[model samples]
Target: MGNIQVALMTVLMFFLLVSLHEWGHYYFARRAGILVREFAIGFGPKLFSIKRGETRYTLRLLPIGGFVRMAGEDPEVVEVQPGQTLAVRVKDNAVTRIYLDRLDERSGVMRGEVKALDLERDLFIQLDVDGEIERYAVHPQALIIARGRDTQIAPIDRQFGHKPVGKRALAIFAGPVMNFLLAFVLFGLALLLQGVPSETSSKVFISGVVPDSIAEQAGVEKDDLVKSINGVVIGGNYEKFVEIINSSAGKQISLVVERKGEDVALKMTPDATTGKIGIYPAGEYRKPSAGETLTYAATSMKDWTGRIFEGFRKLIFGEFKLDDLGGPVKTTQVTVEIAKQGLAQLTSWAAVLSLYLGIFNLLPIPALDGSRLLFLGIEAVRGRPIDPNRESMVHLVGFAMLMLLMIVVTYNDIIGLVRN
Candidate 1:
């Protein structure tokens, strides 16, 4: 793939994965009767946007990450001061819409100076109109229009913090869950496209030998069934054969292969640098039935999840170096290389990436779903929520630290690429 093509595909893949993740939160939040203000894919400036019902779906310029903006999740509040002037649309003596723009000239709109207002609990606005004080009840479904954009007002009941603990936690947890689901589906699809391995025999066949490799120099041909390695009875023990070869790197190894009912003895040395003989193993593959596919997919998910958790454990215990971490640049480089291998490899790589993303989000790190759930757990235990302002500050600080880490990781990736 060309560089431009690789970049575009990488962006598209990220978009699909992130959109699914945020959609999970958006879906559950809506189900919990919380007001979701925006469903944005990517961060930074808006690229495209459209509103449907109560939520504005937006495509942003940067394709790094995305979010589902829920009402009351942000600490910043839109304030209407006592002396501020605004326009309102009334329905049956109740204000159904408030226009903050001064140039709004819609018919039947009442212009007034706000004497007092409360949009959350009281849901009433006392306006000074023509030197007469008037109070109008704000409708529960009132719209707040500003700068040609209309957003529904979120009262206390419609806020995310006010929702039941279970509902709130579900909404927070759904993002990572959806990523796992995507990984499972991707793995299943990849398996369906490329038949699953079905080989289980001690008689390993040499599918192919790399040109100029030690195996080729030693006269190892395709379709040769290895009967023994270095006097060890191979007898279906491919792992033992491999261990012998790896351990005997830069040293000659004897091999006996059965070819056309004849025993052909050969000697070869594994590469000193890589400990590889550059010979491909022959294995049988069979198209999986639906049940087998599901079984294999689930099993693969479980295995990969365990491996990812182990990696996290190593990182947490200081067993991993910072250089071992990969960021977006490394991921893109890997994606480009894998894309050259064929669709099956690319799909499988995507599935693995999805699994990593899912597991990584579930870690109890700040500015992540796991940390949010931690706060909810505390609230549930105490029978009351923590101070919102304090929680928001924690997240803000966490986000800053995360950004710093990303910058360092990205720099390391760039340096690694340059060195390579």
Candidate 2:
């Protein structure tokens, strides 16, 4: 694949994974009766948007990250001063629309100066018009318009923080859960597309030789059975054959092959750099049964999860060096290399990345889902919620620290790429 194609695919993969992750939070928040204000994919400068029900779905310019903004999660307040003029649209004796801009040509809009308003509890708006004071009930689904942008009003009951602790925790935990599920599905699909490896026996069959490789130059044709290597019986042990080849790099080695029941002799030297003759082994794969596919998929997922956990453990214990860490730039570089290996390999790579993303988000770092769950755990233990301001401040600081870390990691990635 060309660099442009690889770059596009990388962006698409990121978008798919991040969108699903955010959707998990969005879906659960709505299920818990919380008002989700915006379901935004990406950040900085909106490229596209539309209002669907109560939520505004937006696609932004940056494709790096996304978010689901639930009401009452942020410390935002709606204030209407006693002397501020406003236009209101009443329906069924309840104010359904409050416009901050000057009145348009709409006939039903009431122009008045605000007296008092209770948007959270009573949902009523008092206004002074022509020296007369009157109060009108505000609809629960009222639209508040400011500068041509409309947002649905969120009452206390519909707010995220006001929801039950269990529901809130579930909503926060759902994102990582979705990532793992996605990884599982992707792994399953990749396995189905690329046949599962079957068991090999005491005889090795040559499936094919790599183009322009030492094995090809030595006339090692497909279907050639390897009888022995360097006068030592291979006994179909692929590992032993690889061990001999690796130890004999850049050195000529003898190979006895049973081609059509006749012994054929060939000599070849392994690549000096990789120590590989580039001959593919036969009977290495078979079409997997449905049960086998599922089993293999689960096993693969578990193995990858364990490996990623070990990586995290190493990093945490200072066993891993700074160069072992990779940020987005490094990820893109890896994706480009994997993209050249065919779709099956790319799919598997994506599954691994998805698993990593899921696990990374579950770490107990502030400004992440895990941290939110941590706060919820504390709330459950204390029988009272933590102060919202303090929690927000902690997340704010954590987010700043994370951004700084990202900058450093990205800089290192760029430097490494340039050196390579």
Candidate 3:
């Protein structure tokens, strides 16, 4: 593909990831009877939108992120004022004669060819709009309805705040959970498309090495056998070998390798934080069964999740440093580079990206879903909500700090790209 086409596809894939994340929140919120005012797939100015029922679906200018606006964020303050003329259009054709005064709490108006009328509080009413019964939900509080505007706030009955703590937590947790699912799907697709590991992967050998990685610098060549690490003999268990390498990050280690029947002793230092030798273990290719694909996806998710927890554990013990962290610019650069490879490689990259996003959102930092979950957890334990103003202030401060960090990371990413 041309450079322009590559860039477009990259952006589209990124947008897809963001859309899936927001859709998870929107789906759960609606399931719990919460009011979803808007379901938007992007940030910034409105590009195009369509209204259906209570929710307005919008596409925005910025393609990096998206949001699902729930009712509790801006609850409707309803007050009835007498003689307030509210324009209620019962039909599409304005000249056809239908006024707000015709609406009342009495025996409801059964117009010519009446469609559907929600009798309770007369909140939801549907009338024929040019051969179609257009449904409208009117909040009991608001009365003024301008053209193409929803005058009704979400009904008090279905407000998010009124829901039980468990339901609220479910709604909040759904976003990150969906991200994991997205990753699983991507991995599963890659497995099905590119085939699975061959039986030969069981043998200890290097298939590839990352440029400038410890293994490459240590003269670890492709197809070279790894007989031992440090002083311990090599094990048949793949997971154990990976754990040993990762945990030994920032430490000097002696490696004994068999190169064409000759044993070679090599000294290497793993990356300080990642413990990455930048080497991919040898894996042969074979056609995958349905069960194998599913298993691969599940295993990928488990492995990625475990790695995240391991990183956190190391960080807590001061074994990890902040310089290892990456930002969106770095991620975008990775995406562009990955796209240059085949679809299978691209899918693998996306799976890792989704996994990282899901894990990151669960951190107890402010202005994140995890922070909201932490607040909900506290409310569950205390049997009451936290002070709204104080919570809001905390999130505001967190957001500012995050923005500043993003600036620094972006600058670093630019410098790195230029250096490359």
Candidate 4:
């Protein structure tokens, strides 16, 4: 493919990943009865917007990330002001429409007059954008914060905060959990198609040799097919082949080979470091036993999560640079490289990527699921919701730090691309 096509495909993949992640949060929030104001799939200016019911679904120009706006970040201070409160019919196309209520500010008793609606009766609110009734709840709070906060503005209804600790943790963890689930399913399918490794034989064909290494000195060349080592045929049971080579480590081994339809004999000592005569192996697909398949899957997940935590700890302790972090450009380069290897390889890497995303987002960094969970944890410990202004300020700081890291990573990606 051309450079432009490759770039576009990479960008699309990025958007897809971010969109699915954001959708996870949006879905859980709605399911948990939290009001989602805007659901956007990209960053920066909105390219197009479609208003459906109470939410304005938007598509933005920059397809890097997404956000879901919900209520209960600040205490609601409802007061009588000229343009502060508005009473609209239930049919209005606004995310948070509020009915005015008489407030003493000190008494804390909010009273509002609804033309024909009962004040003391339970009201059913249908939360559907397509005009089809899906779910409904009683109207609990009257005043809603479109934006900004004041002493007159009261805390909004229970949001990511009001839920039980376990429920809050589940809602916060849903995004990363979804990512892991995606990885597991994708990997499971790939395993079913490619089969699990039944043996452990290294590729007999030499792909390349380490320069100036023993293999190069011993006359091993790329594409050379090994007929045997020390008169032992290396085929059939792959594990036995590996065992033979491993047993010959640090000892001179006779290699019988065929190159360009010509028979050749080469003698080489296996490197004690990696235990091989420097040959790359072709991938052999083999059917796996039920236990073997489960073992492979479990091991894959463990290795994936292991790398994630390793990276996380390193980043925290200043062992890694922020520029090592990657953005769309780097991700695209990787995606295309994996794609060149064919669909099976691509699917395998996709599973790995999913696991990575799941773990990364679970980190307690600002503007992420983990950070939100951290705030919820604080609320749980303090026995009251955190101050909205303080919480907002903390997240703002995190968002800025995240953006700065992104800029550094993007610059690194561009530099690396130029060098390549």
Candidate 5:
């Protein structure tokens, strides 16, 4: 029962964060005077939706993805021939050559095509478009891909391309920027609630001792606070003491610890193995003043962003395994565990998630904010935008590849869960 609650909390928080990310784009797009058609909260089929002021807010079946559909973002032409269809009147019971328009699946435009009308059966004509024959339905809602010449149906003021380059770029970039902003706010709020730490502790203590390790063999026990090593007092420099321990690999050393208010001396030879320490310091956690909170947040944001970049570098370099990456399943599990830990941890986790999402969205991958910005950049340099059809195709291919990667990651997550 507790697990279920935790999971629900996690999923809710996750969805909220993602929705905010999309909201960023929608906000900027509208602010730029571009019309946003839909602000969907998820992908795939929409389960429910509300329409207001020309924008539809949708809740979809998939929880892991969302999008902001801007007006004229893709090459589109909508034509209607709304009415009941009847067999074309045949002349002398012979096939008639006629032109008809219907929706093209690719371009979403009703295109003109010359086809041989049987007028007896099928009653439809086919037109060759881009080397493929497109059959037009003679009924209502029959749309076709636009053939030849550009036929933009949307008003220039409402089209995304009609916006200035900077505005277009800003709208595209807004999603990731919002993610970063959310992380900062969440971090600051959590810090504010927790209060700032005005004190620091550097006391060195063994929190745990690995079995059969040199420290354990030497009779070292957990909760033993170290006062010095080899006559060298830490002097509140806990890290220096660790450095001394690591540097003395394969050498005999005298360890001095405070055991229950008594100084205990023990001798042991350092292990020759790499990463030899079986001992770990009990970490410190503290808060800072209000002024310090801002500084802390900024510094923490920078540091965490750097860590994300490094993590990606490592993953690319084969230092990280595909299984090491988490998908929605892993995120759900982590979220539940963090929620159970308390609000402070959950807030911090959300902040981290926001940072991750922000950085990832800014990556130069197709179907992402970064890629959209790239297309805009090309338009800026070339003094004209690339063909919308080509651009849309590239993004489509990229989306498919991204979906494949997601499926692979999700599969791996499921396997890991089952094994565990």
Candidate 6:
């Protein structure tokens, strides 16, 4: 059941994220007057489709990646149907005669000899379209590919690119914006739903300290209330407590504690591995407030973005191991683990994950929305568009790289699961 819950949540997250991502493209494309041929989620064979306006929205079998197929998005794959000058109609049943010059718009001009029509599956098999044709499968929502004149050139209008640079940037940035917003809301709601445990030492004081930790070495013991660190008095900021621990980074620090109505000092080095004293204080209960929620949300954004950039830099510098990365399998595993803890815990995890996703997508990698924005920036500066072919090639390469990374991460996820 745990595994099943993980799988279910994984699917839910994938669908929601994919839908939002594609909607960002679809919204901007339409606003920019770019003609979209298809907006699809997932990849591989199509599982379902729905036609709206000129677009064929599809759901594919694989849930890894998605696409927004726009006119002029790919210049290499456009098919040119050869011109036909003949009358094509129902003869006895089959296409029979070739009229090189006769043209029929409704019924395509006949280019070959017409033969007798045969009845199969309760319909006339007239060897052509425009006749009574029976579609094999009934998919009420199957979207037809919009027809475009082959001879007529379809260009991506500059009106999209003509918008004020700021507006263009906003349109380009909305995807990440939405993601960040989701994260912020989730963070706030989590606090409202499940309050953060207060950091204040209880009146009863410390319960236990791990052996060989900073507290043990410092001569700190049970029934001690940590009054202050370094000269700063500890207050309501749970986040700040963590920050001080991390910032100290294994440095020896002075800790003032109140024990049995007497003040005592303890000096110890912070743990290198965990950066904590290993003293467990009695948990304090507090109610969430508007100010606290806002502060938490803002801090979450700052902390998460910092982590993302740090990871990115480490990855680029070869200091970070790819095996430390994860894919959907790991995400679902983590999400399910948090869910088992309770709704508030799950919500907080979701918020943090959303922020991470937002930051990751904004990295100026090719094949990402950020890359498109980069192209637009170059175009704005150069006073001309980048060579479409070259741009396409770069994106293709980037896409291949991203896929390779995903596969590697997924492999790592599986390996970690097995080891555990």
Top-lDDT candidate index: 2
Across 121-193, the per-residue lDDT of candidate 6 in tens digits comes to: 2222122334433222212112222133211123324234434555556656777776788889888888887
**TM-score of each prediction:** 0.80, 0.84, 0.64, 0.64, 0.64, 0.62
User: Candidate 1 residues 92-148, lDDT tens each?
Assistant: 888998988864566788888999999889999998889999999999889988877
Looking at model 2, residue 335 earns an lDDT score of 86
For model 6, the local distance difference test gives 0.65
> In model 2, what lDDT does residue 153 have?
87
Ranking by lDDT: 2, 1, 5, 3, 6, 4
- How does each model score on lDDT? 0.85, 0.86, 0.73, 0.64, 0.73, 0.65
Candidate 3 local lDDT, 71-105, one digit each (tens) = 77543443223233322433332211223443443
- Give the TM-score (vs. native) of candidate 6: 0.62
Give the clashing residue pairs of candidate 1, or none.
202-236
Taking the tens digit of each residue's C-alpha lDDT, what string does model 2 give over 119-184?
888999999988899899999989888876787888899999999999999999999999999898
Off by over 4 Å in 4: 1-16, 73-80, 83-166, 198-280, 287-291, 322-325
Query: Please, what are the lDDT tens digits per residue for candidate 4 over residues 1-420?
Result: 455655565565566566677778778877776665678988889999876655568999866678776555433334334323233223233212343433333242223332232212343333322333232332443334333321111123335556566766675677787788777766776677666544565545554455567777988776676677789887544455567777887888887777998979988888776677655544345776677666767778888888878887898899987667778688877898765434555667777887888777877888778888888888788888678688888888998898887888888999989988
**Residue-wise lDDT of candidate 5 within 81-125, one digit each (tens)?**
423221221234322222233332324233343434322134454
- Candidate 1: worst-modelled 10 consecutive residues by lDDT: 337-346
Q: How well does candidate 3 score on lDDT at residue 87? A: 29
Q: Highest TM-score: which candidate?
A: 2
Q: After superposing candidate 3, which stretches have Cα over 4 Å from the reference? A: 1-5, 75-151, 197-284, 313-324
